[model samples]
Target: MTTPAWENVSDAFMRNDKPYGGGAFRIRDSEVMTLKVTGPDTPFKPASEWKNPEIAEHTEPWMNNSGERLSRSTASFIRGTLDSGMTRYFQQQAQDGAWWYSKDWAAQYISTGWMDFTRQEPVNGLAPQITRLWRSIDGGRTWTQLKWPEDRNISYLKFLDPQRGYAIGWGPNVWRTADGGQTWQAIALPPMATDYRKPRKQFDAVDLGPDGLLRVAYYVGMLGEVRLSSVVYRLPWDKAQFEPDVVLPDQVVVRLGSTEEPPGHTYSIYALSRLGPQQTDGDQNDNGKRTGAISMWPGHRNPAVRQLQTFDERYSLTDMDVGKRGVLLVYAGDSSRRGAPHQITLYSQDYGKSWKDIDDGMTQGGWFDSLTNTQYALYAYTLRKRQF
Candidate 1:
């Protein structure tokens, strides 16, 4: 807890020789001392002590998440533009410049596929060339860097076995390696409907499940009144084998993930669907949960997807990630039940089959999220992995 500021008591000094005893003097313990000296602005502005990005410096500052022009460079998709707020974690980012900060400055960029290969939280980043590649032989306890294929803007990659691996990105294309990480062969996908003007694809990413099912997520931008949704595609690793299947008939696919059922778990691949534009938070209702409903496809090649969850338009799907037997989701709102600004982290313990919030303790026990950030004291429940 922050100690309050010291109070001046000329009378206490005059009352007795003991400033803190007979005079009844003590520290005020005011939190004002720790509070930021912020200027009165609707959208919070940098303090006088901070370097105002509006005023250029010798160094070309990064485009702050906030509308300001200076400060550290950040992705375009975060919520609040500063020390604490960021875009949803785990959601696939298709655009090159799109990125998010879950709990730090480490921005995770996306490739062209349905998700990041290392959906692991707090991983360094998916930024191209950050490391050639990260491989974990001991079931992820420790990882070793290997030479990633030099030129592909790979968004998703997973090894089916010791020697065979597949990656998709750089467009609606993919790369495959038969001899582990030594080399990659470019595989071009058949031409997609990119010839139109309305609802052109802005972001694209791919996802592959443990069942060898391939899925692609597309955020098609609305160019005219002719809005389109059925953007997700069931791709063919070998086009000669099968044809691509359009998953959602009318809604846009914003998030895609797959988690194998662990023992008694009913988990499988899932997708979050949005009925409207999927670009920014503005697309969501006032409550933060996006307008789209979350749908799930149960195990063993379940072609039928059932509605898993939906909000009353008050909330939107801000961020998400899949787990071994659970799923992690984050939702933000213009205001909370008490009508204060808030964000909620949702988790599904039994994979995408179910969701509920338990005392994750990270946000439950209110803590300073940053040097100037304080987490919300709300969210009676939040979904998160009980174990790592």
Candidate 2:
């Protein structure tokens, strides 16, 4: 049967739990498209109910940080005006131990989105640090600090699994940990040119390919003439070292050139997509433009490893989630024209080949927390989705 006919039949059987008799099924043809039917006991939970109840009461107090109770006039204004759904979600997070608040900063986690960690206060008379790092295994209820070396600057953090992970900081170095954050070891880095007296750059982002290879991007040097470097390296999870395996095509350099003028400097390389050998071809005409074939090197110490074709776009990628089919790239942008209201954009369903934007309906102002599947009670204005 044609798709429409099949859909009609499917819908008819689903709604009545049987087909209409005498074949006179005259329900609007489009109505037949509704296949799933929800009943009274079909498990409907209000957005408020999904929140942890314990946290709900503290929502306003947490936001204002004032013990004073609001007058009826003020309370009515807030309730009738602001959309409190996001607030309730955040409150739940705090109650569940996923909500993190220091004297200087506060953050909550949304499942599978950008993990938004902001600096709440200044320590030792420094600026309020709004750095995003660390991952939570039990949702946002608790977070494990993923610090780098003696210095507290954490350039980036990537966890392929709960156990295997990699991070880099303000030096030409990468750190690896096999047992979560319990122990860490430094990875061997390739040599830079003698004139490369640029300050050792930090890895801005790291991603693991489906094949288990790791790719990293970072920036080096001072203002005006900063060098945004992209390096594709292979490290066996079994061993604690990284052997320079492949370098992404130089076209990346050209792309960066277009973004940053003469003395090119990159703001950030936030995300990476891994493509198969066939899709890596750079010469293929894309959107009516000739593109260069990206080069990929395989094997270690081969002296003469062949270059393969694969193309991937790196952005100020805020967060990345890899699925079975493709990778999701989330970056900071202003999708809405509400004056400086930034948002997280999703480059959805591209197998490192091409990206399409998706609208997941997130709000501005608040930062993203860790993504997980854990559920909790709703009590306050903020609710936190926990990771188990």
Candidate 3:
């Protein structure tokens, strides 16, 4: 059987699920769209209850940012989600094999198309994709291609406001755009020292801090290599040269967040010690295919290991976000089990010391992969349930 046009979606992530105002954002057939939700009604029905939602026609074909072919790109169309009600953006693939942001509800939006990474080829007999930056102030209803300076691939992109933002690629340097990416300037990064081997930095997280600093995290290991530890660097708000490094123990830091309350500041970090495919033959949940131990570090303190059953092969941590409300955790369960794809959102009001399952009477269906929240509202992106 063929998947219908309405169902041929890569993701249907809920932007919000509140009673009065909530909806979802979806990427289907290379088009970015939304499901308008309006209600003060609590405890809505399953995701299946809603169908044939409206879609925005502004979109492009799915492709990797690399100088690949016009075919399907290995990159996920929508990588990250951020919505502050005023500023909404989606991190996705750029033209020349890098990730860029598409401000969904912004007055000025930007996107890039396919281009040759190397100048050896005449960019489909034209200019390279690196030289062009597409922009649209009218929320992507239209676009205008512009020019750029750097040709580097952005591994991490974070926007503190509509204008102030930071981006970093494979290199150790960081870039800033205070005028909504209209112009970019390179910033110096602290030198990373490797014990013996050359550092292969894999950008993991980049976030804006309360003290007007940019907190960046990366592991010094190549892809698929065993990572010993990770490093967190703090970039000052001003263009001053100060590198504050926080090196972790012998574990790969999968997630990093920080919260500034009153007396002092605390950094919430999630590190994984072990991970592998669980053996599943008879019982899917009983296997250890995705077995791994996740530990948390709440700034300058000993790590707290959450010795829970769900953290075993049956459940895998998918996403983590921290805000004024607290830290939110989204976990994906083994889809083999019945009713296992329901929303699994956990909250840790007291940092990562303890967490509470807060998915009571919420939207149901599929694994919640990415989650972001405002001071009062929380939004999540989920993959639809798999059919047998």
Q: Please name the candidate that would achieve the greatest TM-score relative to the true structure.
A: 3
User: In candidate 3, how many Å is residue 190 off?
Assistant: 3.0
What does candidate 2's lDDT look like per residue over 1-388, in tens digits? 1111101122112222221111101112122111111111122245475466554332333333321211110100000111211111111111001111221122211111111123343454333212233444542345555443433334445455566666654455666777766677877764441124334444434545433456554322322232333344456666655665434432232211001112222211123323212122465644322232222232234434233233223222233433332323334343234554443344434333544443223431122222221221111222222221
Of the candidates numbered 1 and 3, which has the greater lDDT value? 3
Candidate 2 error regions (>4 Å): 1-152, 157-164, 179-182, 193-200, 210-212, 219-229, 249-321, 326-362, 365-388
Whichever of 1 and 2 has more TM-score, that candidate is 1
Positional deviation of 238 in candidate 3, in angstroms? 0.8
Per-residue lDDT tens digits for candidate 3, residues 1-388, read: 2211112232333444332222234332233333222211223334454443443221222222233332222111122333322122332233323323333545433333334443455534445333234444655445555456545545556666556776665445577888877788877665442222323344556655545567666555432232445556667667655474465434344566555444356545454333432232577465344554445445443334342223545555555555444444444444345663554445554445555553322343322212223212222343332110
C-alpha lDDT of all candidate models, in order: 0.40, 0.32, 0.44
Better of 2 and 3 by lDDT: 3
User: Worst lDDT window (10 residues) for model 2?
Assistant: 71-80
Question: Which stretches of model 3 miss by more than 4 angstroms?
Answer: 1-132, 135-146, 193-201, 221-227, 240-242, 260-310, 333-346, 356-388
Each candidate: RMSD to true structure? 15.8, 17.7, 13.0
TM-score of each: 0.47, 0.37, 0.50
